[model samples]
Target: MDGQREREGRAPRRWRHGPPRWNRWGDEEPRPRWPWPSTVLVTAFVLFGSNLAAHAQETERAGLDPFARALLFMTGAALLWRQRYPVPVVFGTALTTLVYLGAGYPYGPVFVAVAVACFSAVVAGHRGAAWAATGTLWAGHALVAHWLYRWLPPPGGPAASWGQELVIATWAVAIVALSELARARRERWARERAERADAARRRADEERLRIARELHDVLAHSVSVINVQAGVGLALLDTDPEQARAALSTIKDQSKEALGEVRQVLDTLRTPGDAPRAPAPGLDRLPELVEQAASAGLTVEVEGKPPHLSPGTGLAAFRIVQEALTNVVRHSGSRHARVRLGRDGDTPRLRVDDDGPATGAEAGGGGNGLAGMRERAAALGGTIEAGPRPDGGFRVLAALPLDAKPATHVKEDDR
Candidate 1:
């Protein structure tokens, strides 16, 4: 289910900030309840305000008949559905306003409904519909006021002046312009919110992969050592009691170290922003890895000096070496492995090889070890190559850049 949501471009419910809020842009936000209070208030204002406007312009224009008052009320009431059905509401309001004007009812707050409807339509991403409705209303009004006024009510009323038409045109243009500006801002804000969610998800996925790699390295190496020591203890229990005691002791230490590392990784999940309780293991702990490998019955020969490395690179290098040796002990028939550490200019080069005719015990079961190593290297702008050597042995080679910083957020793929 979570995978489905991810594939469908939705974050998991657990990661959501809260229930979705209202969005005019159709972003899966819940539909708001009909705007009762605001719509009712506006409708009341338009109805009463039209009466006031009619009283003021009484001598020069037609009086407000029952039909004129009904048109005003209907235009305002149409606002109730503006957000839900913006295009229809806008067109409906525009039509009612045009009819009221054509009947020669004195102009008043009747245009308020048209303005609100247009605003809602544009913000709802129906820009074309909003613009069309506003344009149609204005053109209709111009025709009635100029060319058709001779046959309409208020006998002998003069044709509307060009100045009046200009004012109305300017008002319509201002309404559309303001609505368009609001639409642009709404879209920009939505885009920004989506970007923030994507970044957060990327960071989360990177952290999860990091923890997975850490746990794999720690458990694979330690458990392999423990398994070997347990076997040795069982085999020598009667023949060499003292040797068996030493093997049991190694098992205890390896298990304890594995538990500590696992706990450290878990701690990050629990108290995410807190610093680690212990410093991460690095190349300086090479001797410890050698000792652990020896306990697992693998003779590890280390040549050349360990290169200086940043904490992250050092930890990665240490794990690469650790995983390589674990693979040898678990899969290779050869009891001996060689680790060569050196530098290629500013980059560090690490190679681990075991003489083998192929024991092929499914190295680390399902072969995540090598893939994990490659991911770690790739994250730091480095490379990993692991395969059968030309001379019939298994080899793992790593080249890591010195200037590469710690991967605070690793990409799944370089993009």
Candidate 2:
């Protein structure tokens, strides 16, 4: 019901298309449109004493008082605000009916007031009041309505209608059951919508993280290489124009490659299915990295070959080695480095060591370089430990799952 939307704070008045449709008898209807029951139900009740007089001349039914009819009509009119004041309406109608019955009014369809009131209570989320109304209606039907008819003798001395009493009681309790079922259905629907909203948020976070990793990997590698080539070009520019020209050419190549990788990452976001993926960089490129370091003034040694891994894992391994070498060139003031590849216990491990002092950059605690590496390793269910070695240098060791399903956005404490 749209009223439930209002209760949930959505301000459902905006969705109201027209005046309350009388046929809003179903759960799918927005406002729980109840039949007014104003003119018809009370008028029917008021005519009961006259009808009984016509049927049995000797029967002494209570003559209808103007005040009793006044109260009855008032009870029906008050039901118009049931949606806004459900509990109050139910209690108000029930109290007014009690007064009317006590004032010696003939029994008619007055029980319809309680039935409609109880149904309204349940729809408006007043379960406690609905149950209270159910008990009140049952008691009034069993005691008051029964005695009102059997007060004086009729011609045949017939008892009050037991079958009619049962029918009225059954209708009151049936309305309570119907209201409970509607409440349960609306609760279940609300829960499903919440779950869908949470899932959408998780997907958005994952996409943002993947793009961040791509940018960090591509930009860090290219910028480090360009830094070295620019330094080489400046050093050789005075007397050796030939080598300076070569270094400039290498810088141009690095810029083109970085720009191309950046473009591919952006395209993947815009046209994911249609964009052609470049071969993911992996440990196979380590030799080229070593040669590039050799061009710079650094000595490097490789220990073993890379193991087979998934694409995400392979890219993580490549970036770890790339970041390690970049730190060696930029922070470790040493010329010699060692890279070892092997299995550590049950997982694939990568170890990059260098005979250099533990500078702030190489110590692996501050800035995006170390945080990005940790993020990558943890994304594929892995860990990285980097610190100064006891032998007076920095050592970075990372271990990863042999085969891991790519996970969503990762956190440092994910493991």
Candidate 3:
């Protein structure tokens, strides 16, 4: 169970780490660290098949010379472990080619070994090693062919002719170039994938932070009010039954509203198909919002006629007032507060001010409240101005566009 927990914890951290690293030299880069058994078996089959074909060709061309045939078979068989030790395989095959060329055998097995080494080097992300291996193999073959021609030329003439040398050089360059291209393509694809994954992770983190802040502000303020009202109701249960009943009713209403808000938030957090289909609170609920604040012992006052605002603007206004009132009830040691909502030209404006203590300490707590309110407003392409007022109070002013489209009307409509 402990091991399972460890794995579970690491899974998210690994996901949060973004895509896999593409750095070829890094310890974490993906590579076949060990000699894969399947690769070894496949390489062996290829070697055996190629050697058999070469043997048949050599027999048809010049009859089977026992010594030459045995050397060719052994050289081909040795390539089974080429991927495990590419450099060693290259040297071994080169040596075998020199001996075979001297003994009048074909150079086909050596070319096969060069191809295998190139593939291994590319897959292992060792371009320099592949280049060096190809160069050495070509030089060794040329030198061996020159000597073989001096001793025992081909049926027609010397094997070190310009045509033969050109063919060998071209084949070597092609193999090396192909391997490098494959490696580069793999690296490019890995980089693009990593970038996309990082962007997705960042987006997820930002969304999660937004949800957390909303939950904290909503639950903290709502629950705190319910607790306060419940206490007040209990205290006045016997002496002032009527007021106590009203306090209890307020407690019930606040609790229900808090539950509904939490449920809506949770639904938003749910996976898309599973989320509840509920309409979000908008400016239409502003009156209920005022009543809720009034029940929480705040003197919320409205000043202007409600204006027709865009959905986004309306939601922003509601959240702004919600967060502002929440802060006033929780932090401000004030009994009276004013909330003014109006239209100014093509913009919808909201101003929330509280008659709180004038001390600097009290003023600083409003900073967080103002920030939350500002964020709510700005998310809808709106602007907010919040600070301690000159007249020993706190003020929050937000202006949201009535329409997402550019403003077309400039005439002021004062409330």
Candidate 4:
């Protein structure tokens, strides 16, 4: 978990500030959302051209009113900055439209600018502000239309009434509703992405746990055996020539086998297409393991026939004994230890107890090895109990279910 936090903290510093200047040669910042400045420039030309056409058409009936035409042009130009300050832009455009309407200028281009402002506000995550601005603009439009038509009523001006107000309200609501929908979709995508990342992290943690267990089990058992054989070979070299040669040969053989098994377990990290090495040592190697430990200095007591266990169960049993013996050698300060491997009904039981110095000083306590043992037992749907015995020694007892399915098992069967 600590490693995970460190990785997460470092990931953002690399991404948020963008690539450094040296890496900028081939990389580019994300393009803008609608080429906003270009859009504004093109919109200005179109609106100004339309307003000019309207002014020319009306010259004969009411003469070209340069003042109102100029106001309409300015209002259209003001819309160019709507994205930066949506509410203010909408308000300014609405006021200019009011002035133009009051002065008998055209309405088409003013309506377009008002619509653009409403959409921009909604898109900016300001739903309340958008509604307020839309309401103000709608009121201004109604007031201006009423006043303008009072003097020179259109053919259907009286019928227009408050119905025009309803139309403006509907348009504003549609713009806000569409923007809200888009925002909701974006939020959903973000949540799903977060969930996926969390799941991936959890899977990675589980994998690390599995690897740690494998390393502990393999290294602990093999190293302990090698240590015992090497000690026996050195101790008997001059006193017993025949025994010394046998002990040295045992050391060599054990060392080679340990190296091979360690390499096999490590090869699991390779690509799937790669060939697997030899299988891991399991209960089948228990006698040889007990012999190695016995040679070191411990008196291992054995009883009952070793069961024909599945690969996973065998490895679990082997590791339980290995860790227990390692603890005895390292912390027990005990010259003699006893290992009991047998079956209790359907469960395979492994018990390793040492008649060592049980005082607080000698009982150095189980660290990660203890945690690793518990994890292994729990993963096998079994349980382990380890503590200082009342008689003045440390005892480790693990009972693993032989029938536990291979898929649910933690440690891999491969060596």
Predicted model with the maximum lDDT: 1
| Clash pairs, model 4 backbone | 265-415, 280-415
What are the lDDT scores of the predictions, listed in order? 0.88, 0.72, 0.67, 0.67
lDDT tens string, model 3, 1-415?
Answer: 6577787785333443346554643426543344556445544654565467557766422333676656665556556566556666666665665566655554454466557667667665767777776777677667766764555534544555778889989998888788878878877887787788778887687567557656755666576577667777899899999988999898888888888888887786678556456776677887887787787787788787767776667766777778777667766678678888787777888898998763232311333445555565555567777767888677878888765532222222111
Q: Write the per-residue lDDT of candidate 2 for residues 268-354, one digit (tens) a residue.
A: 787646644677778988897787666556688999879888777888898888878777776777878999999976688999999
Tell me the spans in candidate 1 whose CA falls farther than 4 Å from its real position.
1-27, 362-364, 405-415
Better by TM-score, candidate 4 or 2: 2
Model 1: per-residue lDDT, tens digit, 1-415? 9999999999877723446555643457765568999899999999999999989999988898899988988999999999778999999999999999998899999998899999999998899999899999989999999999999987788899889988998999999999999989988989899788888988899899899999999988888888888889999999999999999999999999899999988888887689988898888999999999988888999999999998888889999999999888888899999999999888899999999756766533555788788888888889888888888879999999887755533334210
Error of 3 at 71 (Å): 6.2
Per-residue accuracy of model 4 over 95-164 as CA lDDT, tens digit each: 7766665555544555666666666666655667767766776776676566645564232344235776
What's model 4's TM-score?
0.65
Sort order, TM-score high to low = 1, 3, 2, 4
* Worst window of 10 by summed lDDT in candidate 2: 20-29
Clash list (residue pairs), candidate 2 = none
